[model samples]
Target chain A: MSAPAILEVDITRKSFAGRDGAAQLVLEDLRFRLAPREIVAVVGPSGCGKTTLLRLIDGLDHDFTGRIVWHATDRPRIGTVFQEPRLLPWRTVRQNLTLVAAGRDALADELLHALGLWPFRDAYPPQISLGMARRAAIARAFAIDPDLVLLDEPFVSLDPTMTERGRDVLLDAWRRRPTAALIVTHDMDDAAALADRVLLLSANPARIVADVAIPPDQRRAGPEAAHVLAQSLRQARAAETRPGGAISGSSGRR
Target chain B: MLPAASTVAGAMLHEAVAGPLLANLGITLARVVAAFTVAMVFGTALGIAMGVWRRLDLALDSWVTVLLNLPALVVIVLMYVWFGLNEWAAIAAVALNKLPSTAVTLREGARALDRGLEEMAESFRMGRWARLRHVVLPQLAPYLFAAARSGLAIIWKIVLVVELLGRSNGVGFQIESYFQLFDVTGILAYTLAFILVVQAIEWVLLQPLERRANRWRR
Candidate 1:
């Protein structure tokens, strides 16, 4: 018997209103699937629809055209850790987690401890440091034990050391629950470090331009593996820049 | 005549002024407390509803706007006629004067909340009650404190007006009596007492709550 598909997005297309009121496509004919516990990293330029894609997948954006199919036997619960910590300034870290954890204070406490936020549990969002706030948000996300996690630039604002710590915490938690995740990021290192498969998107009116699977052996090799993956990404970018092909078509050959 | 009058005023300020001033202060404080409680509860509920529901906001928008702009004197007079100049009527008038201000302030606060946090809450499968308690209420504290402080200040003044206009007791009525009798010392005593009450509210209530609310916002 085969494992079930945890998530599937079929031929998704999203557009926004342009400055002149013209329709600006952000994503075109996007398609993907995730098996149980699969971790996919999405990379693209700043204005590209990377966040849009994640929004579409998370069911936050229903204005787009496409189908997102969740195949788990039970309805998969979705959780997101956004670019900013986005914690309520008035809420203590513990209270923020309790919002979703409901009757699971123990789980929230454990997660907060794991994320190095136990001491700041009673502290409000504005009282904590940016890194601590982000960690709190991460803890809140994981405390729910979601079936699928959507992370949109979750570590974008952190310093190198903080980013590395955050990555470790996220990986540890992901390992524990083993949930599928779709992460949108601009950092190649982040993609290589955390993702099992790296999906590249084109500039605005984004479409998947490349999807490269990293072997388990390669994933264990650290920065050297990231450097190698970066090379593949450069080639993919080169192919994307080639004339006479729509950005979405670039992923076809991959 | 002036020397004897000054001596009489001084003695009057010491005895007759102090006791009534204190009693009236207590009465005014009680009225403010009651009015503020009613405003805070109903205002917050209404504000949250207005903030969260577009249709309800639109429906009630004109009503709130009109009430907010309505003259406090007119409301007080209407309440006196309708409710017969009782304590409840006075309290209700003060609360009504306060409600729209509280609701407007809280509504703005609710509208200013980050959608990202709301979405994060939803994605976690947070129930409605949990979301309100954790997500909504927490974010609402700053605004609530603000509205409470301003509403208290406003209600304190309104309560005095309500007392003076139709009621038999209160600092406002006492002041009116001094005005009619042309007793400057009595007037100054009540004014000083009311000022002290305002200062007490600032120091004892609002300052502490504001400090606590903003403590984590650093």
Candidate 2:
């Protein structure tokens, strides 16, 4: 038998209030499953509720409809990295990481060292550059040894060079712990570079528009594959915007 | 001119004025410290309660608003009338006056905490106390220190006013005595000494604490 699904989302639906005071459906009939150590990238236009989906998976949002089941005997701990590096302004990089580590001091330091952050461990968040701050945030998430990790545009603000470095660090860290991960991003390059499967959503009350499995070799190839994937994503998105298609219902809002 | 200057300086340093100045400074320091301690403990507790419980925030919002706006002198006078003109009454009045401000400041900080962090803590299966000590407390430290420093400074000045109006001893009493005697030199000496003490506190306590709190910010 195939490995059991570590996470399952069945017909999940979410809506919000529209300008006309009507209920605007944000996501509808969205279903997916992930096996252990799987990395799924969720791609969508702005305001497609990608972050909202992550929130629902992490149990931070309860206003949605459907069942999100974790197969683990116990509810697995979740670690999340937001678009912004949300390190505490009052704590050093090391202290911030340790706060979430919960007595895993050795593990915290090891992650920091692996991320090339050991030299600046004592530096406060503000003293560090934007890229460094993002690294620290990544280190903090890894320190917790979570069974599931969620990334919501975690590398949006980085430059090209920093983005490449961040992607490597994230992949390496994920490989070490081997947790199921769901990454939400607008950047096709990011989705193609890191994901085992790329899931696409349409704007406004989002629904699954496409789910493409990326070959293992392609993910490891990096930039060249990223560029090709970006073009394909653009073509797919354009097809989505056509008069009659899978994303037609939500196209008006987009 | 030199002889006149010497005479003024000599009079300002006179034993009668200097003795009371030192004693009153000690008394005032003690009162401020006591009042600040009370404010910190009670105010922080209240602030956390208000932050954590929406019902409590609704229930106590009006009361905090009233206390924050009430004139300090009126509160001091009421305390004197209600509890008698004693050290306990004076200290209590100063602390009560300072409490609302600290609570309001800290409440904002507590309320602004990231919900993600709290969820992360809960997902880890951390108990209530562990969550508080590990997650909540670290995030709350910067706000707590800020409230304490400002609250201390405000309470210190209020204590002096409370002492002057109600008490028989303290920096305020010395100032009153100097005023009655029309002793300008004596008044200046007491005022100068009190100013120096406040400056000393800023240097030794508030500045260092502020630095420590922001050390993580770089």
Candidate 3:
């Protein structure tokens, strides 16, 4: 049986004020629901308003047309890993986590150890490699013991080895104490490996193009197993774009 | 070199440590501290406010520019005329003169703050005080230190002018007194002592603080 619904998003549309004072359409009719401890991955082309959707859902942007509701007994605590590490340059790794989660030193210690960041807990962001910094950012977020976690391409641009290690750290952290997570990524392989549901977004004025659900067992076996599933999703998408294809020009719910 | 040695010798022979020289130096040092503190507090607050709020920044831009251009001497003389030779007035005048430049320097710092870090803080739901202590203030340290270093340089000079114009017992007033009596040795000695004190402060206080604040950068 599925878990209880934890988040509901119903953004009819979203736009930004352009330089010429005209409204630039960024997102449209974007709708999704997240279940408790479920992981959802949002995949889109660059500039297709993936970040905008995340911002709206994260409650950072309020200029959208619809509502985003978090369903919980108490206020849902949120933890986010931005595209950049966003670790405080002046703060040490431990302090960066501790600063946000004051009086939660034990939790922070556990997160550091889990992420292999314990040795560099005293190091500043600049002193660490990009991969380490990214790990630290993840550690800071998880240290908050949040009910909802957001990741915006946290492992992007890392070397292959770093990316694989980062993926493991993220999975391990989530497995220890799972929460409702929404990750925005362009990497279909990573998305397929990590997410229970993959929500594909269309190009600008972004709408929900597809919602593909991977079987639990397929996702459990890791990225190599999920790569075949991801390949089929991509081929299906390509076929939809072809003239008179089986999924021709539908652009709506599957 | 010869003249400096002779002047140093004369000052030692004439003005002992237990005399008016120490009293005057103490008074001047107190004024510098007072004016510097006031200027820094108000300037940094105003700068950060303006930087964060667009409308306030636009409204205050012209005012800051005017204060930045206003002469230190004019400000001191006007304060004396208006407030009538009080110590508060002297300190106020010096602080007023230093305020705008500090504001301008810090405004740039505020503008240059990383929005990414801010978003991170917000997503974590960090409270106002926590954000200020960790995210906001650390980002502004280099700027704050910059304002302080430049503001000190400006405040000390202005304080001397304020004292020279009205105050009875300070380095500036004593220098003027010796100027009239052709006591060149006394003037030289006070200047040298003040310079040494400034150097010591930079070494012991400002430099160390700057290094500590920017240790992460290293």
Candidate 4:
């Protein structure tokens, strides 16, 4: 049986103030519900307001219409990994985690070990490889022992080997402390690998066009096993755009 | 015409050995340090406030501008006139002179802070103190270092004027006495002593502090 809902995101509209002082709509009618420990990946075209949606859900931006309802009775602590590593360049890997989660040394030790960050625990962000830095950022988020985790293109801009390793690192982290997470990515292969459910979104004012669930056994089996499933996610999206021809009309292409 | 380099060096050595040069330097150094610390403390605090809050910026920015443009010598002269040439008045005048520039530099630093790191800090719900300690202060280090370096340079010069105008004893007092006697060598010697001390501070103190702060960077 499915678990009870942990978080509810119901954003009717979101916009930004344009140069001319007009409200430029970024995302419209974005509605989704996340169950406890459900690792969902949001896949959409680049600049489809994916980051905006994540920001709204992460409670970083409040200038949106509608509300995000958390089913959890108590305050739900949040952890997030942005497009950038966002690790404090001035602090060591260990201090980066501890700086945020003070007095939780034992948990920090576990996360550091799980992420294989002990060897460089005292290393600064600039000293480590991008892949290692990315892992540190993930571990930093999990260090807080958060109930909700949001990642925006966590593995983007990495080499193929790094990307694969990053996926396993995230899966390992989630396995240790399974929580409700929303990962925003444009790569369907990554979406297939890291997520239990893939929420397909349409371009421009992103809406949930299709919600495809990865089979239980197929989850986190590496990107190769789910390549076909991810491709199908793309084909289903294309099918949705077939009739309305949302893919057509480049008049507003900026 | 400028004094000969060797003549100035010889005169400086003579002063160092016999004259009140060393004692004067100690006094001047103390004043410079006092002014530097006071200015940095208030300037950094005010700068971060203005940078973080738009209302505070609008309110105090004009005053900072006025202070920034005011003549340092004029401020020192006025302080001596109002406060009666006391040591505290001297330090306060020098501190006030350097305070505005420090605030302005730090304000720019605060405004240009990394939004991504801030969001990361916020999403984790860090307390105000922790956020300032980690997310904010580290990013502002470069600016802080800069204000400090400039403050030292400016404060010492103003302190000299403060000494020259009303102080009983300091490098500036010695320089003034030499100027009156048309003793070019003595004036050059005092100038050389203070320059070397300032340079030593840069090498020994500020340089090490900067290295420590930037150790995390590549």
Q: Which lDDT tens digits does candidate 1 get at residues A1-254?
A: 04567877885668889999999888887888887788888887666888878777777778888788878445677778888887877778998887776577888888887777888889878887888887787787777777788898988867777887888888877876788888888777788788888888777677777778887777735656766776776676668667735443222211
Tens digits of per-residue lDDT for model 2, A11-83: 5578888899998888898999988888899988766888888878877778878998888746677778877
DockQ of 3: 0.86
| Per-residue error (Å), model 3, residue A76 | 1.5
lDDT of 4 by residue, B91-176 (tens): 99999999999999999999999988888888888889999888899899999999998888889889999999989899999999
TM-score of 3: 0.94
For candidate 1, the C-alpha RMSD (Å) to the true structure equals: 4.4
Off by over 4 Å in 4: A246-254, B1-22, B52-65
Worst 10 residues of 1 chain A by lDDT: A245-254
lDDT of each: 0.79, 0.80, 0.84, 0.88
TM-score of chain A of each: 0.89, 0.91, 0.92, 0.94
Per-residue lDDT for B37 in model 2?
92
- State each model's TM-score restricted to chain B: 0.88, 0.86, 0.95, 0.95
Residue-by-residue lDDT tens digits, candidate 4, A86-194: 8889889999898877678788889999999999998989999888999999998888888888999998889888888998999899999998899998888888888
- CAPRI band of model 3? high
Best by DockQ: 3
Q: In model 1, how large is the Cα lDDT of residue B150?
A: 84
Q: Which pairs clash in model 1? A: A26-A206
Q: What DockQ results do all the predictions give, each relative to the true complex? A: 0.57, 0.39, 0.86, 0.80
What is the TM-score (0 to 1) of candidate 4?
0.89
